[model samples]
Target chain A: MLKPEILDPQGQAVQRALPRLGFEGVSDVRQGKRFELEVDGPVDDAALARIHDLAESFLANTVIEDFTVKVEEMVGEEK
Target chain B: MLKPEILDPQGQAVQRALPRLGFEGVSDVRQGKRFELEVDGPVDDAALARIHDLAESFLANTVIEDFTVKVEEMVGEEK
Candidate 1:
């Protein structure tokens, strides 16, 4: 399980501007996490399906954000 | 590229105790990051080899710490 750093530049901008917007004392609002998973597979169609589930069930905060999965064929193999 | 939250629990514990050691204003010493990559492959021997490279060259801060990789056969896929 991996959670990425919560440094939202957009959030920070909003946080800084909030006092002007009549809000204060709202400190330490950080960003969410990002997780990368390396699953062992030829990464066929079914494997892709599971990667989706892994993110939905355990990896991401669906309500707050979304994620993407990239399938890279490890860089030193043939076919 | 996923950079995990820098929350060093051990660091936090040490930070809290620092005042006793005459340390002051030493704030914002955070932890490093964690990245999990899902490479597309049957994750054969060669694939594992590349995953190691991905982490060392791009994913991790080799000078500061180390990371561990787990190869989960994407759940729901057959061998």
Candidate 2:
């Protein structure tokens, strides 16, 4: 996500339009991206660290954005 | 998030590129969006319901995407 101090024009536009669409009471809005990754092996601490590194290096642009990575779920055959 | 059955070309491109970038073990990738909205007053169940309705009607297209809404944090004077 973009840093808290950075300007978020996209979020600002959404916030302004929300009340116009009759969904009132929202004073502020922020937007971010979510990525879901399926790993071939178990998600250990080291694996989590690697994902964090990947997020910092490849997924998110460190100059303008900050990111957090976590395990969402472990998929079985359904995945 | 895009429905499971939907084809995600963007995520597919990322999954294919990750290996080239030396980030291994990720077999698949799916991408979605995150929106954080700040309510003017308290975030009770009624407010949450309103947000969900907004998400369904305005934020996400129910035919292709699904959305989930929850409170992340409550702001004080810093907000």
lDDT of 2 by residue, A1-79 (tens): 8888999999999999998999989988989898899998888999999999888887889999978887777545556
Superposition error at B66 for model 1 (Å): 1.0
lDDT of 2 by residue, B1-79 (tens): 8988999999999999998999999999989988888898888999989999999998888999978787777545565
Candidate 1 DockQ category? incorrect
- In the range A23-53, model 1's lDDT, one tens digit per residue, is 4444523333434343444667876776676
Give the number of the best model, judged by DockQ: 2
DockQ of 2: 0.84
Off by over 4 Å in 2: A74-79, B74-79
Every model's DockQ, to 2 decimals?
0.03, 0.84
